[model samples]
Target: MKRIPYMLLLASLLLNIYSAAVWGFACYAHSGVAERSTYYRQFTAGSDPRTFSVGAFTVTLLSLIVFIAAVRKLRGWYIAVAIVQALFALLYVWQLS
Candidate 1:
């Protein structure tokens, strides 16, 4: 496409990065000074912040990639994939939040 969806791409990239960060945080965040407690455990234990971030990351990456491909006129269902990916990401963020 003549115009690259920079805004969409940036948003998607940021959201994906945010999701990755949260995922990494869950794996690294400490709950106390005495133990190696992480948000990952908290999420698996009961809370669900990690899930949100993960889902967002997955959706965002997929959307951004597909969007770029579609805009660039790459063969295949790029637009559909992008739509699905973006929608999924939004839903994940919304559900978790």
Candidate 2:
């Protein structure tokens, strides 16, 4: 079993989980901050499908890449890049929330 692919998958899973958790928390917290009149606030209240689709597509793509990389026995560095990308993406999700 190649280690890189598993590492990438693990990292991406962490990202997916983090994004879900942050969004969940944000939605919960918004009930208290309902009076804010920001455009972002409006977007959330409207429950934009585009936002969810984009997030799902991106995470799925990352998962596919990781799957391919693992089965193809790609180089360690490539898998490491995926892990790095996933971690940063998770951080970005938190920032957005």
Candidate 2 lDDT (Cα, 0 to 1): 0.57
Predicted model with the maximum TM-score: 2
Question: What's the lDDT of the predicted structure labeled candidate 1?
Answer: 0.57
lDDT of 2 by residue, 1-97 (tens): 5686667566666655654565556566566444322333354455443465366547646765767755756568756755656565655555446
Runs of candidate 1 with Cα error greater than 4 angstroms are: 1-4, 30-58, 73-97
For candidate 1, which ten residues in a row score worst on lDDT? 33-42
In model 2, where is the ten-residue run with the lowest total lDDT? Answer: 32-41
lDDT of each: 0.57, 0.57
Q: What is the per-residue lDDT of model 1 for residues 1-97, given as tens digits with 9 covering 90 to 100? A: 4345556665666665554555557446666532333454443454355454575567576657756755756446655656656665765666455
List RMSD in Å for every model shown. 8.4, 9.3
